[model samples]
Structures are given as structure tokens and as C-alpha cells.
Target: MEKNIQTKYWVVDGKEPDPGIIRQAGEIIRNGGLVAFPTETVYGLGASALDDNAVEGIFRAKGRPQDNPLIVHVADMDRVWELVSGVPARAAGLMEKFWPGPLTVILRDGGVAAKKVTAGLDTLALRMPDHPVALALIRAAGVPVAAPSANLSGRPSPTTAEHVRNDLSGRLDAILDGGPAGLGVESTVVDLSGETPVLLRPGGITPGQIESVTGRILLDPSLEPGAVIPGKPRSPGMKYRHYAPAAPLVLVEGTPSRVTGIVRQMLEENLLRGKRVGVLCREENAGLYPGAAVVGAGAGGEPGETASKLYAALRRLDQLGVDLILAEGVEPRGVGLAVANRLRRAAGKIINTGQLHE
Candidate 1:
């Protein structure tokens, strides 16, 4: 846990990762060392899933809570069978439809992975990342990799290797740079450890897409807007305040005009109070905020665009050293639901104009 740990940094091609560099990074994981690697969604700090000491190192390096479980990434279905007790019919179907993508499924533990990977829980979360670097590293490591967001816990997830180095340079064994992550959010997590599939957390995958596979899935009550997880979270980003930047953030939700108007008003008020205010909005509204620092998540306020740019925008505002941030929320449907969920958690306060007419 010393601050002087020597970290290796390597750059790999996103399309065709260099096998030599991947092998070196894989060896680190095989030897119970931590490595931060890129996935389609975000960069993940990984360790050998079967190594207890290595898994413990991840929590220590990131200062993450031990109770918060980590997602185990596998290169193939064979590894999936090695980690989970069984894959239900629905879970198997989901894997068929969404594997090699940003979807994490929770299943019963098979007692094969490190105890810490499951956080003493009877269930384990597993994913097959779509990124080439991720799969190459996992395959080379020869073990399921237990990983979480590469950045320090509670911070905006890293979308670029530079972001990872900023937060975890001295704390990790190695960092495999694969350029910027595509989705810029975590995987969609669905829990199938029970009779029905439960949406634990929304992410790159839409609920409608999942529903198309499994008839009707239930949403975790904790995911309800304004609802707090009272106890240990069943998934990452559920229990704690995560994706927060250094400055306090306020989320504004309503019609697009209403959200923009309210954020502008707040921006002026904060500026008048001698505060360095930052506005996080769609590219179309970027010109609306004149004096305040403005960062756009995406153009046209599209959910997919917003989701892919949200974390990076938050990190950029942090670098600007703003005293406060006002973020415009997207609609709670499709990938927009995931975008709004992250914004709500990041915001210290939220303003929802109950007017449903968009």
C-alpha cells in the first residue's frame, strides 16, 4: 500500500493488440499483480480472479470497500463455467445475445474464484468484454480477471489511459493503454441468482434489448429515482456515491428547455457568489452558457452520445478546478436511463420539474 510502487505503462493497438505487450501484461496478472486495461465501456483494474492476495491488492490500491464486489471478466464460456455454479436458461440466452459486449450477469458462485471477488456473497458477477485488448489480455492471463473501474473508487470512471494514470499510476503494477474507451460507462448488470432476472444497474445495454431476450425483467427497487440503497449494494455504483468529480454537482431534469433554463440560472447565481461554475450539457446548449465553463456530453442530446461522453466531460470539468457543476439530465429510457442514473448519483442535489410533457 505504499505510494512509491513502480508501475509499467504500455500502449497497445485497439484494433489489433500487440501480443508481446499483452503477454507481458498478462504475466503481471498471472503473477498476482494488478493491471489497468481498457474495455469497450471503460478501463478496468484487473487481477487474477483466483488469487486472493491479488484481489485484495485491487481493493487496497483503489481504496475500494471490500464489501463492494468486483466483476470477473472471462475470455470464453469455458471460464464462465469455471466461476459460476450454473448459468440459468435465461442467463445463457442473454450471454448468447450479448456476450463479448458490455453486459455483466450475476450468477451463483461456483467456489472457484477468490473469496474476495464475491465479497462473501453467494453470487458472482461475470462479463465478456467486447474490446480486443480486454479479450487478448484475459486469454493470455489464462484466468478470469476480477476487475472494477480503473480509477480510484467514487471518482468518474476513466475513459482514457491518461485518466487511468492520473488516478492510479503509482498504485498499480501495469497499465495497458488502448486509447479511449468507446461507451464511457460500465456494463449493464443483471442479476439472475434468483427466480427472475433483476436489472441491478443500467449501462451500455438497454433494458428493452434485455427484455427482448427475457420476457419481462424486474428493476431493482434501489434503482428507483431518489431511492437509496439502505444496506450493502448488490452491484457496483449502487451503494456508494460514485462518478463524482472534485466539485459539487447539481442535476437538473425536465424538458430540454426547462433543464437548460434552470442550469443557466444556477450558473449565474453561483458566479455571482464568486464561485467557479461549470455547466455540463448537450453540444447544442454549449453556446447558451456564456461566462461559465461549459462542457458538452454529446450533440443533439442523444442518450448514446451522452453516455459515451459523460464521464470524460466530468473529468475535464474537474481539471478546470470548478467550484460547482450543473448537469442537464437525459430522459429515463433506453441508454438515457443509464445516463440519468449516473447523473443522479453524481449530483449532490437534484431538481426534477414534474412536468411530463417533453
Candidate 2:
């Protein structure tokens, strides 16, 4: 807990992991210290799930709220039953379809295991992360890991290990530097605790994908301010303003022309008020806002590429010291839905610009 405590970070690449680095990361988890590592989704700040003291360290390191439960990450499907009490029939089916990918299922709290991870809730959110480095560390540590995004809570999730180092360098015991996260968004969290599977939070996996596997429509909970659902949280991103940057953010949604018009209008107004501004948009979309410093993330029309660059773009824009950020919203389909969801959260204000005249 010393302010000047030294932490080691090891950079690993691809499916093959460095055994020495994995061993060190495992040691840190075993000792109740925090270790940040990359998942296929976002990089996760991890600690031993069964160790109460280690779980506490994750909360302290991330400055996360205790009420907001952490997702338990396991190495593989075989270990799923060990963490949750009864894997409901629907949960079993979904796991069969989406295990080892960007899907998190909420299950009945398996008493002690649930207490260690969810702070004693009757439900627990669990996932088997598909990243090799993450799996390597979990396997090496020989325990389930309770992990959330590896950045200060409410800020953008760290996609790259460097992002982790930038936001949490001195705070964590060590970081497993496993390049950049592939999906670059949080996992799609689904609640299988109910009769009908509910889509708690959308991420790398789409709702259609979940429906195809479970044969049921995934429902989004009606979130009220400061309300925590009693059992398991329906979804991870519910009832919270997450993935936010330091500066104020405004989301521009609607038709292309209308969104562009609103951006131009907002930029002009901010400029008139002598406020510094930054814009995040696609290259084709950048021409809509002239004079504003634009950060482009994807080429052509690839939503996956856009999703991958989201948090990093926000971090860059935040570092630029802008007073306001104007983000263009993507179509809410496939990975684009996940991208837009994060952008909407990051953008504090959502502007429906579909009605605006260019």
C-alpha cells in the first residue's frame, strides 16, 4: 500500500505467452496484489476471486464502488461450474455457444464463490475470457480472477497495456502487457438467472447473436439513477455513466447530414464562446467539421475497427486538453451497437441531430 511501491510489467504477444512473466503475474495475484492484464474485450484489472483481501485490493486500486460487482474471469469452460451455484438451463446453452469469447452470464450466487466476487449478492456475473495472455495468467495463478476494466472506474476502459500503464502505473502491483485488446469494448453481459435471458449490457457480442443461441429475446433493464437491482445486476453498464473522459462529451446521433450539421453548429457555438474543442469522427465524416482537430479511427465502413479504437481515441482527445468532445454516433447494429453505447456513455450528453439542417 506504499505510494512508492514498485510494480513490474511484462509485455507478452500472441497465443504463446512468456512463462516467466505469467509466473510473476500469478505471484502477485496469490499475494493479494493487483495485476492488470489484457482480455479479448478490454484489459482487466484482476485479483484472486476467492481471496477476500485480494478482492479488496482490486477495489482500492481502481477506486471502484463496492456496490458495483466485479465479473469473475476463468481460464476455460470446465471451471465454470466451480464459480456459480446452479448454471440454469439457458445459461448452459449460452455457455455452450459463447464460452471463451466476449460473453458474460449472470448466475445464482454459489454462496462462498459469489461472496468472494460479488460482495455476497445472490447472483454473480462470470465470463471465460478468450485472450491467451489472460488465460495464461488465470491458469498460472490456479484460481478464478475478479476483474473489471483496467482503468480508474467511470473512465474509459484500457484497451492496450500502455493505456493501463498510463492510467494505473503506480497504483497496481504489476501489469501483464499483452499488446492491445482486440474487441476494445467490455464483454456482452447477459443475465441467465431469469426464465428469459436478459441482455444486461451489449458489447463485442450482439443481441442477435445471443438470440440465435438462446432462442429468446434479450431484454434491457429499465435503469433508474442510483438504483441497484437486488439479486444480480441485469447488466454491467446499467445505472452508471461509464467510459467517460476528463472533459465534457457530447454525442451527435441521427442522419449523416443532420449529425454533421449539429457538430458544426456546436463547434461554432463553442468557438464563439472561446471554448477549446476536439472532434472524433471517421475520415469521410471529418469534412463535416472544419477547423476542429479531428481524430479518425477507422477506414471505409468497418464498425469493428471503430470499436477497437474508441477508448484510445477518447484518451488521446482527453490528453489534448479539450474543453469539449463531439463524437459521431455509429449505427446500432453488430459491433456498432457496442461502439455507440460506449460513445453515448463517454459523451455525457446525447444530441439527437437527425432533425438538423446542414
Candidate 2, residues 1-358: lDDT per residue as tens digits?
A: 3446577878787588899889888988877888999889999999988898888877777777667788989887767777667887778888888888999999887665636477556788999999888998999888888899999888999998888888788888898887888988999988888788887778888888888878876557432223345553445566567899898989888777778778889999998898889998876877777768788877537889998988999999888899999988787778887887788767678887563223
**Can you give the TM-score per candidate against the true fold?**
0.98, 0.93
In candidate 1, what are the lDDT values of residues 1-358, reduced to their tens digit?
6778799999999989999999999999999999999999999999999999999999999899989999999999998888888989999999999999999999999999999998888999999999999999999999999999999889999999999999998999999999999988899999999998999999989999998998899999878767878767778889888899999999888888788889889888888899999999889889999888999988754789988899999999999999999998788888888888898888899998765237
After superposing candidate 1 on the true structure, give the runs of residues whose Cα lies further than 4 Å from its correct spot. none
TM-score of 1: 0.98
What value of lDDT does candidate 1 attain over all alpha carbons? 0.91
RMSD of each: 1.1, 2.7
Residue 185 in candidate 1, Cα distance off native in Å: 0.7
| Span of 10 residues, lowest total lDDT, candidate 2 | 221-230
Cα lDDT, all candidates:
0.91, 0.81
Worst 10 residues of 1 by lDDT: 349-358
